[model samples]
Target chain A: MEVTASIEKERKTNLWGGGTSPLKASYGKIMMWFFLLSDAFTFSGLLITYGFLRYSYPAFSGPVSAFKPSVDYWPIPEKIFDAVPFLHGVHLPLLFVGIMTFILILSSVTMVLAVEAGQRMDRKDVTKWMLWTIVGGLAFLGCQAWEWSHFITGTEEGMALSNGVIIHGANLQVNEYGPPLFASLFFFITGFHGTHVASGVLLNVIIFYNVVVGTYDKRGHYEMVEKVGLYWHFVDLVWVFVFTFFYLI
Target chain B: MEQVVAVEVKPVDKKKVKKLWKIALILGVVTLIEFVMAFTLPRGYLLYAGFIGLTIVKAFYIVSEFMHLKHEAKALIWSIMLPTIFVIWLIVALLAEGGSILNALY
Candidate 1:
């Protein structure tokens, strides 16, 4: 009884005492932030690896019209990502990717709105916003699937390899784009990000269900929504850099 | 018997909701600018720098406003952001090494 009293006194006196959260956040929220920081490092490592490999190859020079896909140099991104869905055969560079970016940003906005609703303990608004966010995520994923298929199917006139092999689309072995490394990195980086989005959508669904079932209403707080919102925003953050490095640069 | 805790649900803050939409509008406008620049600006370091700058701007908004980091404690913000400096160092070191390798190969 004496020890318990002494510890309680220490907790009251000391900010660093074990009883208090010095960071002004719950344990779960702190852990979530650290997890996101580490995940950011992982993504940075991948993107930096891409930068290293990209710089190792000679950049394609001259006009875009004069550019051709070869193992010789890096391919122009505009030429490679020129195709748009449904508008087939027409050259619309970066249009699809722009749409994808907008969808992600819109979803992020909806997620923040859900978090705001969660703060007010407004279950109805939370449900509505989460559903919209989920739809946005699904739409983005569908767009990615179409893009991957388009890339894998190759163009009508595929590029010829140095060894006289005429390859159509892209694989780990060879791609009709430019350097084989380009396709490899594209698949790995974007695939990893897409997997994150897929899981994010799954998480959103779970959270949405919980919201509908009044789980947070029982828990006395909606901190779970805020945690997931952090993750979803991080995904969008990474995509911003990816879009710049992979496409714009 | 189940223990029931009463949670105080405050009225919705119109200012907060308006701020979120305002940020969203900013993001959309910046993205539109990027798209327009992609076609008009000649591909070079200038364009790349602009894109990177804008991307950083967008990331700042997302992290600060959407993630609520701005409202978080200062210690939490520092702990999360300070480590990312290492990533910048890694980028510089690796890119230099890549440049050297390129020169050696050629």
Candidate 2:
């Protein structure tokens, strides 16, 4: 009776002492959460840096129709990001980015659905949803590539630098946009995000392969899918903020 | 004597699947609203605040429902969220510095 009492006390008091899952989560899952948290910090750092630079610039204040890129002020986002795929010379204004946002959100949904199917140990369902998720990710990446290409290939009438040198498109050194920093930040932030999406698609493919081979079935759990889903959702979450800060604001 | 262990497979829950789609719909509508406001509303502090507020709303749904962070242990949730406070702090501090620099330059 005394030993039983002591065992109960130990269980309550030594929950995190050792050899116990105090958080009621598997070790792998807890580690994944921490990794995500660190990644969140990295992204926040980059975005906050963007905010700082943006604050330092005087915003362009004029009618959109009359707006022109200059070194003196920050260019309006809508005026700059107005092009759409195959709709050359037409001013669409954030339409392509809005579509990219939709694609990322849809991919996030498919990833969560894959996680749900994994909970049920339904391999077929997991495979289907994972494939869809990969496709959505690929689509987003393709859209980003197109957007980058457009930014690199500037408008027909390029902006003249203060030194009187006309630059057509954006490179590391010069751009037709307002401030050269604008193009630099745009490349860094979106390029970083695009890299994440690419890696996420690769991870999804690996997990999908494992699901096909029934590795999880032998292991008797779909926790791997859950881990990768956490990562996939994180990529989507970061894009949500990037969309707001980069495109909307 | 021989013993056999059978893996348990639960039936798919239709309600859960429906809820996931419901969350997706909410996200889609929120993005659409953002796009509408971007063109309709004039650029100013109010517009910026509105955009940020809507963004947080979308983030809550994604993290809580899609990422399943809402159902996790309180300790885990707190651990993740508490560090994000520093990120908020950094934004305020750095933006202030940037504003000062702009004032000095102009």
Candidate 3:
């Protein structure tokens, strides 16, 4: 009854208030949503192009695969990202990436907790959970660093082609695992996703500082925390797709 | 200047935290399932289809729960949803055009 009464009073005040927000969400929040939606499309286009190119790669026969992997087939994802971190030379095959995925999702959980705490105006809990979220994001980036280096250094073998051309490791021109095109796509897609994570981390740092300095407290709302949380979660969401399309599939 | 009055904040709910943790568990488990299936499933359409299906499930959970899109206004939700149809169009169009390009090369 009390909540309903407050809401009714708010409606009365809102009706008289000029420049009302859409669906009662502030202009900032709605603008963030719009930015995220456009970003989602950019990622979608890249991923879809990846799918189409990968699907047609084997059958294209445009003098491309003639110089790529032997037997005219796309390199299996498992064969490429099989190296585990710190073990020097071991075949883990999705295990490291699996752990990375877990880390990202766990970070998303912490992000939610931070936002939840902010909603309750619990500054201490918000700071704590936001710290955890930052740690998780950094940990995932560290794993990516290891993974990328491994891909670059390669191992004892590079996938030999039909024309006696052996490409070693990954560069703009070639990769040991498969064709140069595959390597380019791998670097571009994962690199783009990693960039988002990096920016999300940076944003979180700023928000965390604001939370500490009582910016949100002064404003009497933690909506900024929630907005940044949305972006953090979206970064995790994009990684989910990248994991499936780039690593698993 | 307007008078500044302190607002009383409500206590945080324990149930909300529990719900968030539960969703996290589900996401982790689904990802683990994908990892396991990667090794066992024979390389074929079935494996690809299963992975894609599980991926969609994870995406739905993350967007609706963690991102709180589920509780948003219907009009706001529809605005996002309707434009996503273009993503589908993009995929179909690219694959079909790519297939023809490959066929021409063949």
* Top-TM-score candidate index: 2
Interface RMSD of each: 1.6, 1.5, 1.9
- lDDT by residue (A211-237, candidate 2, tens digit) is 997888888899999999999999999
Tens-place lDDT digits, model 1, residues A105-141: 9999999999999999988899999999999999999
The candidate with the higher lDDT, 1 or 3, is: 1
Give each model a TM-score.
0.93, 0.96, 0.88
How many pairs collide in each candidate, listed in order?
0, 0, 0
Global Cα lDDT for candidate 3: 0.85
Model 3: CA > 4 A from native: A1-22, A59-71, A161-165, B1-9
- Cα lDDT listed for each candidate: 0.91, 0.91, 0.85
Sequence-dependent TM-score of model 1: 0.93
lDDT of 3 by residue, A198-223 (tens): 99999999999998878888899999
In candidate 1 the C-alpha lDDT for residue A145 amounts to: 97
The collision pairs in model 2 are none
Off by over 4 Å in 1: A1-14, A17-19, B1-9
